[model samples]
Target: MSVLVVGASAAGLTTAEALRRKGFRDPITVLGAEYHRPYDRPPLSKQFLLGDWDETRTRLRPDTMLTALDAEFVLGDPAVALDGHTVHTTSGRSLTADHVVIATGLTPRRLPGPDLEGVHVLRTLDDAAALRRSLTPEVQVVVVGDGVLGAEIAATVCKLGLSVTLAGPQAALMEAQLGAVVGGLLGELHTAAGVELRLGVAVDGLTGVGGRVSGVRLANGDLLPADVVVVALGAAPATGWLEGSGLTVENGVVCDEYCRAADGVYAAGDVARWRAEDRLVRLENRTNATEQALCVAANILGERQPYRPIPYFWTDQFSTRLQVHGRPSADLTIAEGNIGERFVAHYRDAGRIVGVLGWNAPKQTRAHRQHLVRT
Candidate 1:
């Protein structure tokens, strides 16, 4: 049997690696839209953007290990359409296999604005490279989102001694995800680090002068001046290529509990919306990319196990490293430490612990991870 994986990023690469580890000697092919070798994206905004890590440091695996897998790597050609087990690429090439896996990941969302210079988005290696070149202490930078990516960019830019203003509709950074309690603390951290917080205000539009970004226009009719603007407005699953492929697409490619879209087709990573208990859940994070890929690989080998996992996510901003375990969406309460220093916060829903989080305290927070009642 042969397998065709439609993405060559972390998720796709991990799936192929897992297959090889499980003793699947079948011929495997990994296809990618980008020409770059499989690279880790989590560093793109931190170490890479800060120029602390080189291109070789960001690669997920070196040439030696990838060669050991013995999988065909077809780069730069994007898959455009799918007909059953057959995938057609833009270069007029078609590949069919006994099984197909979709791990295409996400595309950064952009606001309706002019194609002005100095405005950026950080998703791909190219995006990170362009934004890195445009960043300096000379420019007034405005990050137009309070989400994870936007917050990271703001932190990284501010660390470089550049003027950064984080503008978003949320009252605090990551409010929608971690709740107000933790969000408030995060806001304090950014403020302490000299990042101008323009929260609870929606961005009206972008102002450009002579085809370059001049400032960001707020919904309240105020303009924050800037020479560079980075739009960190979340992302959507990259499933546009799966259109007309007779697959269910709602937020992401809908799949069964086993992550199988059809008899011989499966999906992993951000592109997959699979059934988890009573709800359809789609996770978009680095940990899920590796974990879910292993699950999919097991099922592809006929293990037939479901992909139910306790969600995990983390982010670093300035001097703080926040770690989250399970779904931290309910009422947040401090389990240890305080807001002024390292602490552990737990989320409770109906008087039962659902999630746990740590701020600058990795070991303590990891100890409290057991409080999260797994579903």
Candidate 2:
């Protein structure tokens, strides 16, 4: 059985590797929209932005290693359409396979303003490279959004001898992921790093001088001066291209608990929304990418296994490594550990462990996740 995987990022590449491990000898093809080799994205805003990596170090796999897998790599050609069992590429190529996996991931959300030269987003290697070239001590970088990506960018820019101003609608950094308590700690950390944070303030619009971002206007009649603006406004699943594909698309391409999609198609990573009991969950995490890909690979090779993975996520900011296990929603009661050298937080729903967070405490959080009662 032939397998055609669209997207060669973490989820798609992991799916192909898992398929090989399962001994699927049929022709396996991995298609990528980017011209460069598949690489890890989590480091794009951190180590990569800080110039700790070189071009040769950015690739996920060397040409020799990928060739050894016997998987055909179609670079720079994105799958444009899915007509039944056939995959149509943007480069006028068609590949027919018994199974198709959609792992298109997400695209960075653009802001409403004049097209500015210094405004950027950190999603791809090109984005990181552009931002890296402009990182100087004289540059005053303003980052939109207080999510993990924005926070990381703010932290890294500060380390690079650049002044960074973080703007977000949330009251604290990582409020949605780490809850209010840990988020408060993050706010202090950013402040300690000399990051000028403008939280709970929405940007009215961006001010540009000669098609370059100069400052951002706030709704409260405040204009924060900036030479460089990084729009880290989160990501939406890259499902717009699949609008007429007949697959359910809410926040992402909806898949079953087994990662099985419509017809002979499947989805994984940030682009996949799976049914987890009563809720349709889409976890945008690397852990989810690898585990769900393995599940998809197993089902593709005729193994009837389900993808019931506990949602886990991690974020590295400065000296802290915050790890999350399970879902954190409105229904859960958040219980946080006292702020100390190391942080640990737990989310309990109806007295059952539903989620846990640990800073530099992976083993503790892993053990805590084991005690979680899946409803």
Candidate 3:
């Protein structure tokens, strides 16, 4: 049997490694759009952009460990189309495999404006490198979108001594995910760290000079001067290649509880929308990518196990490390600790703990996460 894994990022690499570790002696091939080896992405916005870590240090596995897997690595070539049993690549190569695992991940959503030199998006290693090259203490950066990615970029740029303005339509930072109470605390955190927060503002367009982005125009007719603009408006799944592949593609490639898209075809990571609690949900975090890939691999190996995990994610900004477990809800009754110091919030739904969030309270939050797993 032959297995073809599209995408060579964390999800794809983890799936391939899991398959081999599970004693699958089949011929396996990993296809990557990037020429570089699989690397961790979380550091790109933090350590890598800050120049504290080099490219070699970002690799998910060293060359020695990758060589042990004995899987063919086809880098710099992306699969453009998929037929029943054949995968077509942009490099004019056609690979036939018995099983195909789609882990194509996501593509950054571009702003509606001209493609200028200084406008950037942080998604890949190349994106980070380009953004880093343009950063300096003199440059003023206006990040559009107060989401997790935008918040991280703003924090990183502020730390680099560059003036950063974080603007978004949300009432507070990460309000949709963390609720207003915790999100308000984050808003205060960023403001205290010298990041100019422009909440509840919508960007109308970008003004440019000499064909490069110069500033951002707001809907209320205010212009925020900027030498660079980073659009962290979230991302959409990279599912264009699977257009006519006879698979269910909704918000993402819809899959069953087993991560199966079709017969002999499975999907994992950001590109997969799996059935969870009677609703289809797609997670883009690194933790979900790794966990779901392992589950997909096991299912591919003939173990009929359902993929049901307690959703977890974390973010590091400035001096705070926020960790969360389970689906946080604004409707749940919230019990919060001191907002001045290290804070912890316990969210309960109908007398049962549904979610827990912590700001610089990792140990206590982790202990509370067990409640989610047990119940």
On lDDT, the candidate that comes out on top is 1
lDDT of 2 by residue, 1-375 (tens): 899999998999999999888777889999999998889888898899999987668788888878878999899988888888788888899988999999999999989866889989989999999999988779888998899999999998988878889998898898887677777888998898899999998878899888888898888999999898999989999987686778888999988877888868999998999887877888888888888888889888878777788778888887778888887643433344446567566776676677888877777767677766543
Per-prediction TM-score: 0.99, 0.96, 0.97
Off by over 4 Å in 1: none
Misplaced by over 4 Å in model 2 are: 329-338
Q: Which of 2 and 3 is the better model by TM-score?
A: 3
* Poorest lDDT segment (10 consecutive residues) of candidate 1: 366-375
Candidate 1 lDDT for residue 22? 98
- Give the whole-model CA lDDT for all candidates, comma-separated: 0.93, 0.85, 0.90
Tell me model 2's lDDT, rounded to 2 decimals: 0.85
Model 3 lDDT per residue over 20-84, tens place: 99999989999998999999999999999989999999999999999999999999999999999
Write down the TM-score for model 3. Answer: 0.97
Error of 1 at 255 (Å): 0.7
| lDDT of candidate model 1 versus the reference | 0.93
**Model 2: lowest-lDDT 10 consecutive positions:** 329-338
